[model samples]
Target: MSNVVARDIELDFLDHDFEFVGSENVSTIDSTYASQPYWKDVLSRFVKNKGAIIGSICVVLIIFMAIVGVGLNEHTYDSQIIAHQNLAPRVQGLESLGIFDGSEKMTTSSGTVEVNKYVSANGSVTGLEDTYYWFGTDVLGRDIFTRTWMGTRISLYIALVAVLIDMLFGLSYGLISGYFGGAIDNAMQRFAEILNGIPNLVIVTLLIIVLKPGLLTITFSLMITGWIGMSRIARAQVLKLKEQEFILASRTLGARNFFIIFKEILPNIFGQIITNTMFSIPNAIFTEAFLAFIGLGVPAPMASLGSLISEAFKSFTTHPYMIIPPVIVLAILMLSFNMLADGLRDAFDPKMQEM
Candidate 1:
């Protein structure tokens, strides 16, 4: 059997050619691959996702606009022009590009303030004020353009701060709880459950009632129960990671619990934490908006997207523009966050990365 198996095998005449040609003709197969870090692989996959790239660009643009749009505008968000009250959004000529001014002015020292230029049947001018309301004016005649941008800034800030708070508290809480299983884990998890059981909105309402309605108050309220969800997620990840071979190996090596938990386990869960944060930000934004819409948000003179929508609801029939802009902004923000989070999840997935 061995002699027959070793006998020279020959194929009948075929279309294929087998010859000792140049080195280029000889194909060498290699299964070995160069070492590549985890994060590099994640980033390479992340940028390749079209939806995520577009969403990231949009988010960056929104952030930039939130930071710079109001600064470039001549009008202050709070500045009111009674003469231009309830004016509709109008983009005349190059006004949209900021190259041309479209304003109507009225002197406080003078008489009857006017609006858009009008010629009566008698050919006499009725209203004429040189004031530009680019996004038109709110009922108080404040610039919607500046106010919307300002609200964007505030909302983005809240999302960032709230997420940071959640990450700091949640990561630590979960790590400690999961790393040290048994009675300690049970106690910590029960504590988190107790906190989560209390409705966050109810807590927010109670806090707002106790404290004044302001940005700081809103922030504190949102952050109260927000970290619980993240903590649970982190705890789950740590629970899974702690039972792994490497963790046992580290324990055998006499590594400290803190070092093992942070240095060994935490790095493995970093991507998951980031993805969770991205997904959580939109929820935080929506919470702020909801609070603001019900008049439980920032106080007077300060405009949030929710507050703006509430104000717009009063004049919905007459001016729909007020509701449209804020709705669009909120929708875009939420969509971008969700898309980016999904992208990150796919990027960090080993199976998906392989695909």
Candidate 2:
């Protein structure tokens, strides 16, 4: 009987030692809340993305080169050196390290030394004089490197301005139209649709044809249709959000319509607005490049990447390097913007975090 009782009475902590062990492993649950704001969470997530960080760095570098470097450079983009016309790329002491390829031939006193671009007609190769072309000179002897960076700065600025215009008008138009539904929304949307029916490419082309290609002309033309896209996006966001509980609560609290839309609704929709703007930047840039490429860009003496390519295309065989640098820069700028947009989209998406 005693052996059976001992076997049945197994050791167990059915009643924990409340006095000694206390509540080390167990406790009554209490309310908890994060000390940070929602934006802080978003920022934290954005920082975690490696691609976004890299893209941000590249964008900054590009902007810095465009503004700071261009400002500091002594060689103006348009300042021509006719004597140094068609000079191939060369750097001091880096020719042996393959800065200039073997295909690069220059007329030196030593019977046409290959890859020697830093030679003047003094009959003696003094090595890297004023003839030093970092990325070579064009047929007109303009520094290709300087012009390329300048063109980038111009293109980016134009695109940025266009996107800003789109956002300002679009966001306002959309928010108002969406917030006030019924006949107003219907009429506004129909008008937008009618305008949208006409292709933007055709509009810009025709505008340039009429006004002639200049900075102001191109900017005005781009603005004509740019805001329509932004408006549509804004309208959709406002529509989706206007009926939310907070929005209704704001309205019920006697908040003015403007305050409700701008203060209450706009804050929630900032992510989408920014992401859309980022995406539009590339489009605007490509459009500007295309216009410039097809003879509708900035006039001669003012170099643009597209215009440079167009000029270089005529004698590509003679000076192919002239075109390569601009193309590469343009591609990198577009690519970095796209990467940034994607990263922002992913970072802002709550569903992605849950996954």
Best-fitting candidate, scored by lDDT = 1
Per-residue lDDT, model 1, residue 73, is 65
Global fold similarity of model 1 (TM-score): 0.82
Compose the digit string of candidate 1's lDDT tens values, residues 1-355.
4554567878797556665678988789788989898889889889999999989998999999998989876788789877666675666565558432333333345654533332244667646333555677788878888899888987898888778877788778888998898999999988888888888778877887788888888778766777877888888999888989999999999999999988999899988888888988999899889989988888879888888888999987656666778888889999998999889989988576566
Model 2 clash pairs are: none
Best by TM-score: 2
Model 2 alpha-carbon drift over 4 Å, by segment: 1-35, 101-117, 120-130, 352-355
CA lDDT of each prediction against the hidden true structure? 0.81, 0.80
Candidate 2 lDDT over 1-355, as tens digits, reads 4554445566666554445646876777887976887778878888888888888888888888888656555688889988677777766577668766313755546675455446545568654464456778889888888898889888888878877787777789899999999999999989888777888768877887788777877788767777788888888999999999998898889999999989999999998898888888888888888888998889888887789888888868555677888888888888888888878877788575456
Clashing pairs in 1: 102-132, 103-130, 103-131, 103-132, 104-129, 104-130, 104-131, 105-129, 105-130
- TM-score per candidate, chains pooled: 0.82, 0.83
